[model samples]
Target: MTYPPPGSGYPGPQGPYPPAPPPAPPGPGYGSPHGGGKTNGLAIAAFVTGLLGCFGVVGIILGAISLGQIGRTGDRGRGFAVAGIILSCLWIAAGITIGVIAANSDSSGGSGAAPSATRTKPKEVDAQKMKVGDCINDNTTASAPSTAEPVEVESVKIVPCTSPHDGEVMAVFRLSGLTMPPESQLRQRASDGCKIRTRSRISRDPAANSLANSYYYPTDESWRSGDRSVTCVAVAANEGTKLTRPLAR
Candidate 1:
């Protein structure tokens, strides 16, 4: 093969080649596709709060905000935000339904009559009008009065002893002194005197064994209002039974 002329620049054993271009700059979408965007924090919080069930309204509000942010920012957790909103709505509806049912139940007052087991207010009568051998019914006598506090009598009803009664007035004696004694002393004296009187009346009878003595004394308030009488009563030992006759002779 004849070589090109020496003075004429030409490729012989090696052919002329174009130089390599510099590497292309990294593109905008380079590196990991998942590197930039993150899960919305509010969305995660909303989902957790909804699961807790206590802050349903708050969860709903947070979920709404999270959804808007997620849509604008292209963040993750879209599913989480949606779930939170749904759970919150359901919880709110359930709470309202339960509240309504409770209100209705309370208003209905089940069967429109007071339960027989519950004690109702007894008929009211004047305490001064009470007399010996009279049958009386009182809420205070439904159960044993607490000895720690002065016995309070709201009202009383004088019923016939032949019918069922709570107690019979064994005695209606007035305190001798014009000046009232301290409540503690008065209560003690009244209780002891009434117990003695009741024992004397019932000692000969077999039914006395099934009776318990209880007495009511004037409080400071009542004494100031011109009341000084102490009333004694014998309640049935078996609370379920009612006395058929006057307990005292």
Candidate 2:
């Protein structure tokens, strides 16, 4: 005799199982529950600005905001937010480095005279080392005086003759005597010498005509240190005007 199936009484086979319940409706995709799988708008903005290397600070801010939003709302573009932040930080660092280098280069100077490149860039020059062709920008508060004086100055900003400048060195000469002279006598000597040297230049160059004579003489302190040179400068005839071209031939 044949054994009967346990679930059925003497059954040879069981009916096919009912079709597996239709795949549970696919659950919302990852990061789409509330976000609907859309990329964050701020993330795109951040990436674009960072890639361009402009508005780096703004890009960093936008990336931070997007990252927070993606975490909370489960939106896409998290990678973009992180990349934007990294790129923005790098750009900011690079910009700072360039600025520092430029500042240091502009502030540095050699001893005797500015480099020949002074025609294209600005450089600092020691007052006693100024040469006849040097063009200087006046940053001091005092108005340009027609007469020369014995004023104490450590250095001056030498600029290109093509650029705006307050004065041009017309002459460089040394005063006589081992001892420092009185302030009035020194001033008078400097004024007269500067005027005599610049007379022909003013008559020849119309630009020089519009300028007045000025000078830089060593102070007693500088004098004792063997500073005997005087730099005769041609300044604007009028207080506010500036020289726009080279006064030298």
Candidate 3:
């Protein structure tokens, strides 16, 4: 049998549906009752900057947090969150492109050139092993079998000379690998494929092989070894020119 119902186990039909459970306490950062829910100023700034990519990924983080909080308070600013995502994507794209270009420009010159940089050799100095800041005082030309027919390269040698046309200064870097240049990088400022190119020559030293037998300078192409690519400048070794010494590497 049911007991009398005043404050019994079962409530009467009325009682306003148990007076609705007490509202949940405000979240951690919401503070005391006197203080109301407030958003962080830095978070707002980050969200805005992130959309511009100025904040990069940092902005994305801030915007995400702010966006999440908005759900709890029904706030606005979808623009800021979207902006942060856009910025992060842009930063990633730019960074990736830069990294790839640098890698391509640095393909290697596989041999022992980089390691033997300290060794001294007989006859002509191995100039290719020189360092960035180091300067050579001698201009001893090295010789190899002429790769071109008719021994067009005589014996693959070089001397010193200055530019008559006085071309502008261009790129610079250390020498490595076989020192053989890429076919594309060099051009005879005067002739087709230039009969003979010099690094920066005005004339040839009879001492270091003749123009007919010398290696062309101002190499039109870049060369690769184990893992390094060397750049060269173009200088023709035709007549009306001379070779100087202590060539700059």
lDDT of 1 by residue, 168-212 (tens): 777776777888987678878888888777778767556878887
For TM-score, the strongest prediction is 2
Could you tell me which 10 consecutive residues in candidate 1 have the lowest summed lDDT? Answer: 114-123
User: What's the residue-level lDDT of 98 in candidate 2?
Assistant: 93
Clashing pairs in 1: none
Better of 2 and 3 by lDDT: 2
Whole-model lDDT per candidate = 0.74, 0.80, 0.40
lDDT of 3 by residue, 70-149 (tens): 65664555556656666777777887898887776555433433523223221233334423222222222222212322
lDDT of 2 at 105: 72
List, residue by residue over 97-136, the lDDT tens digit for candidate 2: 9999777776774344466564477788788888889899
Clash totals for all candidate models: 0, 0, 39
Better of 1 and 2 by lDDT: 2
TM-scores of the models, in the given order? 0.45, 0.50, 0.31
